[model samples]
Target: MTPDEFTATYREHYPRLVNLARRIVGDQATAEDVAQDAFVALLKATLHDEQTVPRFLSVAVKNRSRDVLRHRKVAHKYAPFETFGPLSAEYALSVALFIDIIAALRTLPASQRRAIVLRTYAGLSEAEIADRMGWARGTVKSHTARARASLRRELAEVA
Candidate 1:
């Protein structure tokens, strides 16, 4: 894509892509960085189809988000050394739970994922999520409820 096309695509998909990354990595700043890096990578890539740009960006964001999560897991696994102590069982359990939550979040549909992530992770109210996602308040509620139910099912074994 040309620079102009890339700019337009970035403007259109950036928020959703960032949201996607946030769902996986669970950090707003890191999500934004992942999205930005995906755009940068897109700019460097050669694609014959403009329609595939969004897909490309989404895949790139997901892969990069997983990388962030992996690196975080590794850092947390070894964090006790920096603190001059051994890793606590509680800390290890929390890390595993976090990883499970992210995996469960990924299994949700897009609307449900957006709703729950905004509500739980980003700490947005239902109205705010509706406004950001361009859905009705009721729709947001429904999505959030269903998403929560699905997450509960997916993570029940963990608990």
Candidate 2:
């Protein structure tokens, strides 16, 4: 599709797509990200028909939402705080804190978010992240450092 057509399509359907994802994912920011990802997929697609674009985007959003739900389930299953044994006060507090940390992570810039997730969640080293992300080691270090500072500030505010 033409740029103008794509812009119009994005403007027309973005909000509805986000709302649909939000209903599935139960998070506004995540829904927005999911919708944006769908748009990116639409751009990458070869389809050019106006009538097919919206349907394509809708399916993309739903698929991404399902992926997010699956990831959430896996994360919850392996959450470090789950080692607390039972639903005690400490377990509840830990779960709440983990949720807050995730929200804070979402508020970070894309580069910072990627760096932090690779380092913290995936247990990758700075060199490994740099290699995987196709960046210099210094760049990875900077992104992770900035991400850490931002997360500290965000989590502090939550506390």
Candidate 3:
């Protein structure tokens, strides 16, 4: 793609790509970084079919997001104390609650988790999620419903 073409593609897809990455990684800043990296990688790659660029970028973001999540898990396992820094009591409590929520999200099945995150965090409507996920609207609704109930139960148990 030429510079102008690339710019247009970025403008069109950047938000959706960032939302996808955020759903996977659970961090907006990191999601934006991952999406930018994917676009940069696409710019570097030589493609025989330019039409496949969007799909390629999406897959690239997904892979990068998974890699980041894996790295975070391993690092947290080995160096849990490194994450703790100076913070007010209220801030620390909020962080703790966020961690608990993330843990609850992890317990969900992959489809349910994705549905919940895409709906709640990414703020995508059911139809949008259905199109992106290649599922029927009903499937997205079911997944979101079940996931919400599961999360509510889990959080209540924690409380």
lDDT (10s digit) by residue, model 2, range 4-116: 98899999999999999999999999999999999999989999566898899999999999999999999888889756357978878998999999999999999999999
lDDT per residue for candidate 3 within 45-92, as digits (tens), equals 999997898899999999999999999988888876647567788987
Candidate-wise lDDT, in order: 0.92, 0.94, 0.95
Clashing pairs in 2: none
RMSD (CA, angstroms), candidate 1:
24.3
Clash statistics: count for each candidate = 0, 0, 0
Ranking by lDDT: 3, 2, 1
Query: For model 3, what is the error of residue 126's alpha carbon versus the real structure, in angstroms, after optimal superposition?
Result: 71
Question: Would you list the rank order by TM-score, best first?
Answer: 3, 2, 1
Lowest summed lDDT window (length 10), candidate 1:
78-87
User: How does candidate 3 score on lDDT?
Assistant: 0.95
TM-score of each: 0.50, 0.52, 0.52
Superior candidate under TM-score, 1 versus 3: 3
